[model samples]
Structures are given as structure tokens and as C-alpha cells.
Target: MQEITDETELRELIGEPLPRAWEKERTSLHELDRAWLAASPFCLLATAGADGSCDVSPKGDPAGYTLVLDEGTIAIPERPGNRRVDSLRNILTNPHVGSIHLIPGRGDTLRINGRARLVRDAPFFDDMVVKGHRPVLAIVVEVEQVFHHCSKAFLRSQLWQPETWAPQAVPPRAVLAQTLERPDATLSDLEDYYGPSYADGLYRGQ
Candidate 1:
């Protein structure tokens, strides 16, 4: 097997894209693009660190949780999590980010490539509050290019089909602790620990 190292060789192998596919990308959000973002409850955010290492993280909430501030700007609230802040930290060093928005039962996805910055403005942060908990920060994206990605991937994977899903139950905390070799933990204690996090923000930092 030989490695393809240059764009010319790769492009020659794949050939030119269809005209409509090439022309579908827009500099700003269009009506349909806005609609897609409004209906999509989940998206994957991709970022690269200064060291060139990359990471992709999942962001999700209710439908339209990601706000379209205008045709050229989007605001995404950062929910509380493990607090590693890999994406947020990457944005600080490198403003470039790519996000793919997905809607259940929809074959086509929305892709956005742009520069991002973290924000903590008062009223903006207040607007993102859920269950009396506001995020410590939000990400503002300057729209550069947006497009409706094709459906072949979703069609092949049948991601939205319930019949294709795996049936697996979450193990009890005692079992989980034992698997991790934590001797003194109980299922009740684990439940008690995780229960409050769902209602109360896990990381409430500014």
C-alpha cells in the first residue's frame, strides 16, 4: 500500500465534487440553516490545541439550545461537566472550531466552520440558565462557512433507528466500584453522589 501525501494526488483520486455540493456552502446562516440549528439538540465541537492535538466534545440540550444571535453569529452555552474544559481551553489558544449539528430522524446534518471565543457577559450568561443554574461561560462563533452535509453517513449507520440500537443496562455502583477496585463504595452512595449533579450544576465556577 502506498501513502497519498499531497492534495493534488488525493484530489485526482476523488475527482471534483458535484457542482451543487460545492455551491451549497454559505458564508452566513440561511433560513434552512437556521431551522436546522433550531431543531438540532446535539452537536459535536472540534478544536485543536496549540500543540496541534485535536479533540471533539459533544454538546447537547433541548432543541434550539444553541442560539443564533444573527445571520453571522451563534451563541452556545457551555454546560457543566467534568471541568477539563478541553474545547474551551483550545478555543483560547486557537480560535478555530468546527461543529456538526445533528437532528434525530434527519438524514442530513448541518456543519459550521468558524472562529470561536469564550464569553461571560451578564445578560448573555443569564439567558442560558437552566434549572436556576447558569453556565460559567458561553462560546460565540463568528460564522465563516456553513452547509447542510449529505445524508449517506446517517443512512449507512441507521443512527436514528430504535431497532438498531444496543440494549445494555447501566451496572450498579457497587459493581462499577468493584470493577474499578474501589473497595468501600456502595451503590447507594454512588447514587447519592450523582443524583444532585443532574439538578445542581456539577461545576459552578466563573
Candidate 2:
């Protein structure tokens, strides 16, 4: 197999991007972008460290979880999760981040690129409280590039179609955890840990 090492070769194969693609980007949020943020409950945050290592973390909360500080700034609440903090560590090293916001049943997504910083406390923390828990930290982004992505990929995957869903087609989460992550744990124990009530502890920080 051969690789195309230059943009010239890559573009020759993929063809030039449509002019509208270039025209769609904005340096700040439009009214539509704010509306999109209001309705989106989830986003994928992409970050790279100073050494160029990368991480993509999924952030989800109720809709409007990402607060718009201004047309060019936004804040995302950090909910409890596996404490890896890969994205946060990367942001400390390299401020740049890219995020894609998504809403269920919607193929198009809102893309945001910006510089980010972590804040331990802010006046807005009170607004982010859910289930009596407020985020200990939040990611504030100075937006640079914002755009709406087209839906070709979602359309091809039929990701929003209920008929194509087959969540049980593979091994259950409990089985997988026991087989790959916790070999010493019994299947029954793993099942009890990840059973139907798994979501009950989402915001309960350990």
C-alpha cells in the first residue's frame, strides 16, 4: 500500500472542497449557532498536547449545558467521569481545542475551534448544577472558528434510524468488562455493577 504524503496528492484524490464549505466558517457564533447550542446535549471535545498526543472526550448533559459567554466565547461544564482528564491535561499544555456538538436525530453538527482554559470556580457554576451537583471545574473556550457540518456521513450510517440500531448484537457491557477490564471479577459482580441502574451514579463523584 502507498500513502499520499502531500496535500496536493490528497486533494487530487478527494477533489477540491466546495466553495460553500469555505464560506461557512465564522470567527464567532451566529444566532443560529447559539440556537444549536441551546438544543445540543452532547459534544465531542478534541484536544492535542504540546507533544502532539491527542484525545477526544465525550461531554454530555442537559441541553444548553455549554454556556455562551459572548459571541466569541463559551463554557462547558465538566461532569463527573472516569478521572483520566486527558482532554484537560492536553488543554493545559496546548490551548487549542476542536469540538463537535450533536443533537439526537440530527445529522448536521455544530463545529467549534478555539482556545480553552480550565477554571476551578466561576459565577456560572451555579447555573450548571444538576441533581444537586455542580461541576468543580469548567472549560472556557474563546471561539475562533464555528461552522455547521453537512450530514452526508450521518445519512450514510442511518445513525438516527431506530431500525438500524442493534445494541445487543455484541457482548453486553458487563460481559465485556469482566472479560477485558476486570478479569478477577466474576460476571455476576460485573453485571451488578453495570446493571440497569448504572446511570444512577453518573454525577456521584468518587
Judging by TM-score against the true structure, name the best candidate.
2
Worst 10 residues of 2 by lDDT: 197-206
Residue 26 alpha-carbon offset, candidate 1, angstroms: 0.6
TM-score of each: 0.84, 0.97
Off by over 4 Å in 1: 169-206
In candidate 2, what are the lDDT values of residues 1-206, reduced to their tens digit? Answer: 89999999999999998899899889999999999999999999999999999999999999999999889999999988889999999999999999999999999999999999999999989999999999999999999999999899999999999999999999999899888889999999888888877889989963
| Candidate 2: stretches off by over 4 Å | none
Give one digit per residue, the lDDT tens place, for model 1 in 1-206. 99999999999999988899888889899988889888999999999999999999999878887888889999898987878999999999999999999998999899999999999875767667766777777999999999988889988998888998775567765567656866577767666765656445444532
Q: lDDT of all predictions, in order shown?
A: 0.86, 0.94
TM-score of 2: 0.97
- The true-structure Cα RMSD of candidate 1 reads 3.3
Return model 2's CA RMSD, one decimal.
1.0
- Which candidate should be chosen as best, given lDDT against the real structure? 2
